[model samples]
Target chain A: MQSIDHHFLDDYACRNALRGIDTRIKLILGLGAILIAISADTPYAPLFIAIILSIVTVFCAEIPARLYLTLLLIPASFALMSVIVILFLTGGGVPILTIPLPWLTFTATDVAALNAFLILSRAIGGTCGLLFIALTTPMIELFSILRSLRLPDEFIDLAMLLYRSIFVIIGEAVAIYNAQVMRNGYSSFRKGIIAISMLSSSLFIRAWDRGEELMTAMDLRCYDGKFEILEPKASLTIYHILPVFLFLSLAGILAFLPLPFPPL
Target chain B: MHIMEGFLPSPWWQIWVVLSAPFVIMGFYALRRMVRENREALPLLAVAGAFVFVLSSLKLPSVTGSCSHPTGTGLGSVLFGPFIASVLALIVLVYQALFLAHGGISTLGANIFSMGIAGPVVAYAIFIAGKKVGINEIVTIFFAAACANIVTYVVTSFQLALAFPAEVGGFMASFMTFGAIFAITQIPLAIIEGLVIALVFKYIVQLKPEILIRIGVITQERAERLREGWA
Candidate 1:
């Protein structure tokens, strides 16, 4: 039997403390913070949002700190690589440091360092904002929110079907892969290519078959060409809405204020 | 080739969002029409979208001995036309952003534009041109897949250049810098993806030529020829 954790973030979203909070509020806070963070000039606001939102996710939402950090490492790695490049390649203001290499000399400028820092902080803040939504609000709630927002019913229905199919197809792909590995299907470069292609093709056939079954089932049920969305049980309360509003406003206000510290 | 969240700051992200919206809107209409024409197409399209997501998540062995994920958009565009492929890619990108933390919500517009719209459009165009010119089916599939993968990265590089031009050399130099970084990892992966997708196309032709024919991916004559050659 698969544990609840088998579904990864979805499991957490279903069980989190903030899960009962209205999704619209969560979305607003998350997206509002993201917009503020990305558009902010200094690193302070984004860095603040990053640190605060992370604490909320880990403590308030009760997400595992280790898992959260590990998930964060994905975007962090990309940010680090790009920031290093920007630090060395982007030139402005006073020269900060110069290192000589065999092929080329690298120089870091004050402006470049600041720019890189700003970008890195923004990336962190934005990721935290996104993860907050991912961890606290399940995709089902999001779909309902989209529905309420008056998105096309057909599009929502299709999105729901696609979402459901992803897990089924992933399970099939995984089982096939394990079987392939057991049979030494990926021993060599050529063999590996063939194995992967075979895996993909078989998976494609499985999806096609699954699609047909779904259609038949829907038809049997007198398919109305629309899916009924389970309205999110969470109700709008001042308790939920107020905090998000206050937090976003705080982040927004902080975004415009100048930092007290001197320039690098 | 996902640009990390908040990587595109200010006007750049907004610009990409604006530019990508039109294509996505068109894709949405195309999707609705496809489903309306034949209700059965709805579930198949959904599953096809899921297939694209799963295909991208798989690790492929590259020439450099390192493993990477294929974009999977080329095969999608070939199987479903570019318009529907764009919608599928959009859904996949959203899922990846939410579940995998591999991409950011803020940059979804840019990512959708690159991996979803531009790549599929190019792939479909290449496949059509290849067929029109009577290119070898296998070779055409390879190039279509490979070029789609490469073009996604190239467009990403272009977005980066536009966002952060180098101080000395401006857009051209920044583009070269980003392009070089992408080409190093991406070119090899693209080649591997091309080869794998070509093989997958071959397998599909042999096993389920009817599906391809139904989808208008290949004519009955070509499917017959492919089946015979493979057999």
Candidate 2:
């Protein structure tokens, strides 16, 4: 929809302040926050996690606040829609709000309200955690970490190849799509289907050609089964590790705390 | 339809990861064997994975005025075997989660299970069955792709229902509610996906029948007949 700005996330990741930190630490912190937020029974901890992670991603990571919020809006909107459905359709305890319609009645019970809040907060927390990682660590850095984690070499190698070729394939696809649009190939639904199928088939052919070229190129280089991936040189500093531990423990403790006020 | 980031609470997500592990492992073994037998399969699989990613990025014009993208797993499954398709789907999905932020790492397992494993396996099965039953190739491809999309959404709905069962009528009612809502948009999208993939198959049949035969999708005799018919 946005003309496929391929470098949007990677641009921030390359430029972020936390880019200097060890990627493994960043991943652990971000993923741990998400796990804790989701597993928590109450909504308070997740909501708190969302706010804290957003602040870190914006202020500390030095990501542009406007761009970060724009990305956050995508998931937030989806969560809001699901929350609305959850609020009205589910029923338990006393009803908090009711609307009488001609064909049917809608009710939002207290239990449903709380459940909706939990879902909304979990979504927010999870999205923030995910964004924090995406904004800080580029995928190139993650490959070595995957290697260190003892993941199979073949799996990692394939991931690397997939990563490298995805951009080229996507560029070819975008070029074809633009050409199709110029010709009014998508003027009607039927035409759109035809245009897309042509696009997909042609892209597949292009990918096949590229794959053959890659294999030939690699073979020319001696056809070794190993791909040499350099590990990032960032050391594990206590300054980064201390803050992550503190923040996660703080969130973990917060999960067990009672809500400051009871919902009506 | 990805289950969104952090949508499935605790045990459900973990369970999906466990359920999906075996298939992914099998995919790895298949991939390893392919490479050991012929190193060319490695780059082909990677590029195919990238193709699936780009396909997901394309917007489909739907009758409901809501645009959705083709999953492309159906095409991948039909072109490559289901096992390799799972590996390709896993790669595409991880990239989608990390780079695009369309899905989440926490829920990656669940998404992979539905889109990567379940959808592709079903699509491959249908494709094979249709061939066995001597059905028309276009009709078979259409149903293979369409049913793949439908089964993906059904599995997603089942996962969500298990996580958030209804207080009034429990898991069954919650599943029906989710299935109904997903059906509203997904049914039309599925039909479109089916048509698009079928058309892609037709183009491949016209241009690269040899590749189809190589992949065991079409027999040599069938390709010869189709080429004669076209000429």
Say which candidate scores most in DockQ.
2
How many angstroms is residue A39 displaced in model 2 relative to the true structure, after the best TM-score fit?
1.2
Q: Compute DockQ for each candidate against the true complex.
A: 0.63, 0.68
Each candidate's fnat, in order?
0.71, 0.65
For all candidates listed, what's the TM-score of chain B alone? 0.97, 0.96
lDDT of 2 by residue, A1-264 (tens): 343436448767989998889988999889988998898788878888999999999999999999888888766544665576678777888999999999977789998998888887888899899999889999899998888888777788899999988989988878888898899988887898899899998888888889989999999998677799877699998998999999999999888777553444
Clashing pairs in 1: none
Cα lDDT tens digits for candidate 2, B36-60: 8888877888898888888886778
Tell me the whole-model lDDT of each prediction, alpha carbons only: 0.85, 0.84
- How far residue B10's Cα lies from its native spot in candidate 1, in Å, is 0.9
lDDT of 2 at B76: 90
lDDT of 1: 0.85
DockQ of 1: 0.63
